[model samples]
Structures are given as C-alpha cells and as structure tokens.
Target: MEYFIQQLINGLTLGGIYALIALGYTMVYGIIQLINFAHGEFFAAGGYMGVILLSFLSANGYLATYPWLCLSGAIILSMAYCSLLATGVEKIAYKPLRKSSRLSVLLSALGMSIFIQNGLMLTQGVYDKAYPTIFSQGGFDFGNIKVSYMQIVMLLITILLLILLNLLVFKTRIGKAMRATAQDKTMSSLVGIKSDRIISLTFIIGASLAAAAGIMVGMYYGSVGYTMGFVPGIKAFAAAVLGGIGNITGAMIGGFLIGMIEIFGAGYISSEYKDVFAFIILIGVLYFMPTGIMGENIDDTRV
Candidate 1:
C-alpha cells in the first residue's frame, strides 16, 4: 500500500509535466487542426535556453550571489524565447500552408520538426546537458508514504496553469474568437475575426505551455537533452488523443491518467518497460473510445 501511494504521487507529478505539454497540442489542434509536430522542438529549445541562461548567470557573477534570482531569470528567459519561437513557426512554416491540403501542412510540420531538431543538435551538440535544481531537497512523510517537495511544487504549478488556461480559453474575448474560428473559419472571417491572428495566438500559447513543461522537467530530473522532447511529445499527443483531441479539459485529464499509468506500471510491473505503459493505455483508450473520453465536438469545426 505504501509503495502504491508513493508511486501514485510520483505518477501525478510526472503527469503534471505531461499535462502541460498536452495542453499545447490540444489547443493548436483545436484552433487549426494541425498537429504542429515542431512543438516538440520548442520544448527542447526551452530546456536548452533555460540551461544556457542559468549557466551564464552562474558563471558571470550576475546571479552568482543570488541563486534564486538566477533560477527565476532562467525560467523567464526560457518562456520568452519559446513563445517567440512558437510565433515564428506559425508565421514562417505554417501560415503559408494554411490554405494548402492537410497532408501538405502535416508534411510541412514534419519537415519543420526535423529542421529544428537537427539545427539544435548541430548547435548544442548531441550531448546530455545537466539541469540545475531549484527546489530544496526533502520529502514529507505520511506514515509509510513519502512525497517530495518537487512533487508538490509540480502539482501546484500544473493546477494553477490548468486553471489559467481554462480561463483564457473560456472567459476572454480572444478565447471566444478562437472558439469561433475553430467552429468555422470562413464564418469567423466573415464576422471580422482575423483567423490568422487567432491561429498565431494559439501557437504562441501552446508553445509557451510546452516551454514551461520543459523547464519543470529539467528541474525535476536535473538533466535535459536535445532529444528530450521526443518521447514526452509523443506521449502528450497520445494524451491529447486519449482525452479527445482538441478538447482542453480532456487533454488535462488524459495527461494525468497517462502519467499515473506509467508510474504505477513501472513500480508494480517493471521499471524497464515503463515507457511502454503510456502507449498501452493509449491503444486501449483508442480501441474502446475512438473519439476519446470527452468525445468529439462535431459541431465545433476547430478539431
């Protein structure tokens, strides 16, 4: 029981990371029906940016005396860089293909993904870089179960971001515009909504979320690599599909559920094959619920 509880906590924390990335996938899909495969590269970019910023700060004496400030600075810089990258991708790679066939757009996305990955690999080299630890090292104990401060922080951040995303999607004018655009781009354009702007905004928002997840993963695991985004990106996409592609709330739920399954499967079944656990769940979910847990919003043309 104690082992189960511990694994549960671990699973939830990891799920939080997955949920953050999944939000980006679902949001972009909701708005444009494009998977934005290059998104994984954005995640990698954020991690690398954070590492570089923090490393520079540590070495230059700008943050030598203030460790906490360095950490905060790294996070801010990473988020900003990633947000810009996301917007740039929308402008350069996706915008031109917006009117093209879905297959063309998808292929373009794939090309962008490869381009970014190889670009990073060439620039940063194909080596695993060390990530700095921000949170204090300690765990709270409950009977035989233990939860780390990192886990608690991750959970809080995930919940807070989820709430913020929900508000942005459902309560704001931009949110309404996004929904309208998703439902019918032509109608949205006719109503004076700039579909292009909305699409760019969606990409920006999604990229930023993925960036945050990258930073969190770095802090949690104390390391990152150029290829770091590959597996997580795939898993997040699976989560998006499992929860219902293009559904915000569904993505969140699916991410957490996937995380839980992976962690528990590792703990109870075999740590060696933990990664396969998410795919297994994904397959299972698709087998039974093709439209995902939330079901497809057929009337909402966005997905």
Candidate 2:
C-alpha cells in the first residue's frame, strides 16, 4: 500500500508536467487546426535556457549566494524566451502557410520541429546538461513513503500556474476573444476580434506553460537534453487526444490519466513496458471513443 501510494505521488508529479505541456497542444489546435508539432521544441528550448542561465549564474558565483532568487529569475527568463520563440515561430513558419492546405501546414510544422531540434543540438550539443542544484535538499515522510521537497515545490507551482491560467482563460477579455476566435474565426473578425493576434497569444500562452514544465523537469531530473522533449511531447499529445483535443480541461485530465497509467504500469507490471501503457490507452481512446473522453467540439473549422 505504501508503495502504491508512492507510485501515485510520482504519477501525479509526472502528470502535472504532462498537463502543462498538453495545454499548449490543445490551445493551439483549438484556435487553428494546426498541430504545431514543433511545440515540443519549446520545451527543450526552455530547458536549455534554464541550464544556460544557471550555468552563467554558477560561473558568476551567484547560484549559492541567492539560490531562490536565481532559480526564480531563471524560470522567468526561460518562460519569456520560449514565449517569444513560439510567437516568432508562429509568425515566420506558420502564418505564411495559414491559407495553404493542411498538408502544407503540417509538413511545415514537422520541418520546423526538425529545424529546432537540430538547432538545439548544434548549439547545446548532444550531451546532457546538468541542472545546477540551487534548492536546499529535504524530504517529507508520509508513513513509509518519502517525498522530496522538489516534488512539493513542483506540484505547488503547477497548481498556481493552472489557477492563473484558468482565470486568464475564463475571466479576461482576451480569453473571451480567444474563445470567440476558436468558435468562429470569420464571425470573430466580423466582430472586430483580430484572429491573428489571438492565435499568437494562444501560442505564447502554450509556450509559457511548456517552459514551466521544462523547468520543473530539469530541476527534478537534474538533467536536460536537446531530445528531452520528444518522448514527453508525444505523450502529451496523446494526453491531448485522450482528453479530447482542443479542450483545456480534457487535456488536463488526459495528462493525469496518462501519467498514472505509466507510473502504475511500471510499478506493478514491467518497467520496460511502462511507455506502452500510454500508447495503448491512446490507441484505445482513438479506436473506441474517437472524440476522447471529453468529446471534441466538431464545429470548429479545419481551415
């Protein structure tokens, strides 16, 4: 039972990270049917940015003097970096292909993904970059289960960000505009909502969440690499699909479900087959309930 509880904790932590990345996928697809396959690169870039910033800080002897401050600043800068990178990618790579066929847009997204991955490889190298330890080490005991402080902090940050995001999407004028554009781009433009700007903001918001997840993953795993995002990216996309693509709440629930599946499958079954569980669920969901558990809104135009 203690071991089961331990796996549950681990699953939730992994789920939080997946949920954050899955939001980017759902939000972008909601507004524009483009999958933006390169979205995962934003996660990799943020991880690299965090490592780069921490390296510079360590070299300057500031990491030890102001660990929390430095960590906070690195996260902020990494998120900004990813957010700007996403906006630029949208304008440069996606916007031109907007009027083109879906095949063209999808191919462009795949091309961009390749381009970004290789760029990160050339710049950050293929070697794993270690995240500098700025956090004070400690753990809490729950009976026979022990959870690290990093786990607690990561969960807290995820919850806080989720709350803020919910407020932004549900309460703000921009949020309403986003919903309007997603619902009907033509009518939104008719009503004076700039679909282009809303689309850009959607990418920005998604990229920011991806960045936050990147930071958490880096801090938790103690390492980041150029290819780090690929697996998680695929799983997150599955989560988006599992939760009904284009639905924010669906993505969140899907992420947690996938995470739990992976964790429990590994713990109880075979570690080698852990990844198989998520893909199996994804296949099952696609085959059985194509609309996902949340049921997709089919009225959105693909174009």
**Ten residues in a row with the worst lDDT in model 2?**
294-303
TM-score of 1: 0.93
Candidates' TM-scores?
0.93, 0.96
lDDT of 1 by residue, 1-303 (tens): 888778888889988888889888988988888887888888888888878887777678766588767776777778889989988887888899888988898888888898888888899998888865545367799998988787787788789889988898899999999999988899999999998988888888888888878877877788778888888998898888888888999899999988998998888889888878878878888888877888575446443
lDDT of model 1, residue 72: 64
RMSD in Å for model 1: 1.9
- Best-fitting candidate, scored by TM-score: 2
Report the lDDT tens digits of candidate 2 across residue range 67-181: 8898889999999999999998999899998889988988998988999999999988889999877662678998999899999988898889888988888899998899989
Q: What is the lDDT of residue 205 in candidate 1?
A: 84
How far out, in Å, is residue 205 in model 1?
A: 0.5
lDDT of each: 0.84, 0.89
